[model samples]
Target: MGTFLGHLLPGSFFILYASWHMFSVFTKYFLSQRALATTRDQGGTGSSGGGGSPSTPYYRSTCAHVFPCCPRIPMEGIVKIVLTTIGFLGELITAFEDGVFVHYGNAQHMTMYFAFGLSGVFDIKVSRGPRPALPNLDYVALAMAFAMEALLFGYHLHGRTPLDVQVHMLMLYTIMLCAVATIVEMAYRRSVLPALMRAFFVMLQGTWFVQIGSILYEPLTSPWDENSHSQMMLATVLFCWHCMGIFLLMAFVGWLLNSRVKRMLGTSSVYCQLERRLEKGSATCQEALQLTEE
Candidate 1:
């Protein structure tokens, strides 16, 4: 995982998964709010618009939709399994050279991918199985995946230079936070904030992976001096920048999606009111005509 492509591939995978999770969380939330608003407008007292109950079909924690056409299908889980399987196989092939355990770094990577791939399988099982498991098996599996990642990364930097080790340590912090957040999500599946936090940290990990690759391997620029104090300082600052950038991105996406959902619900409400008024007017006119004929 020292090469530019090595980091970039996993980085891209994390970014893709995190982005899709962000989109799914935002869309499901506002859409559920729209449903609640519609129920209110129609004068029906509905359940709270919080994350769906475990008894129902879906919730924020289980927001995994890969295809818009097949919304009900567990495509996200399927995709996760497929992608992680590829990553796992690639790592396996790299780790074993002529049936020998030559590259332990690749072996480390293989474990990380295996954990996430197993989580994906659990997600599919919970999603399609008879009933939604209490305490959320999906969240449990996800938390385990993040924990495994944090564990692997914590031990991955034994022989690296100070700068390289420092950069990876920062990444370890993010992975730990992701693990903690996923655990919180497991406990409180109704709260949308924990799910959002998980996605945020996941994206941070993605971007930071790219940053580490560039710093350590000089993929696109001159090699950063591993012993320079200033280079390490710069890495810390850059990590902060990545955090801020991801936060703003999530906020903007949420706001935009919320506005669109509101507009859609607003238009529907207007149409319903108009239809009701027209019906009332038609009934009044027919009664007047009947009275005149009598």
Candidate 2:
């Protein structure tokens, strides 16, 4: 039971992490569009008002449509939000199946459906974008990795089964490369040459983490007899593995916050200082830029 408690805290953290991610995407999108709008209002020389905001309904009189090359580079922000929602839903399902939440003890089924419903938001968002990860796919993958990590962490808490820990941890490893890649991308953005080199290996490290974690989890059990020293060793390994996964994901998040990147869906860009004025801009803008900061 004590061991169970250890996993629970991590799980809670994951749940919160997912929530924060979705919020971040929304916030980023809102801010970017706002900035874009403001930029347009000012109509700066380089500001293209790329595609238009996300909130625009279909055929709502010409906004950014899907594109190739950048592979929906135009819709990157909003699409990520949709994926974030899906990540949350998958997590909620995993949580219930793993017994992380009871929603009043017997409410598991009801809770799961609720989880699925709420999670659908990501799918809607995803539908609008090209596949995940193209324009800096690593960063996108990094975000998705973070989302999954959060979910697993949330559910791992109550998992009495080895499957719970192993599967969750395995996915965590997959994100490490994404995280590293994201960090590398940020490094490039920040203009730090050294970090770029580090990114190459970090990506590999992330890959190994997944491969090895999976290999180790194959025979491990969550509930080793109370006295088996060997089981204790295994748990130690898992804990370390999970911790590494945490670091990788955190690194990406830390970069986003530090850089103050946009984090929203097709919410609204109506507030940017420079974007409010363009002649055709308002006509092209959509409602998705509204920041529901409340």
Off by over 4 Å in 1: 47-60, 132-134, 265-294
Residue 28 Cα positional deviation in candidate 1, in Å, after optimal superposition: 1.1
Cα TM-score of candidate 1: 0.83
Q: How does each model score on lDDT?
A: 0.72, 0.38
Best by lDDT: 1
lDDT of each residue in 74-93, candidate 1, tens digit only: 67788889998999898887
Collision pairs in model 1: none
Count: clashes, candidate 1? 0
Where's the lowest-lDDT run of ten residues in candidate 1?
A: 273-282
- Which candidate leads in TM-score? 1
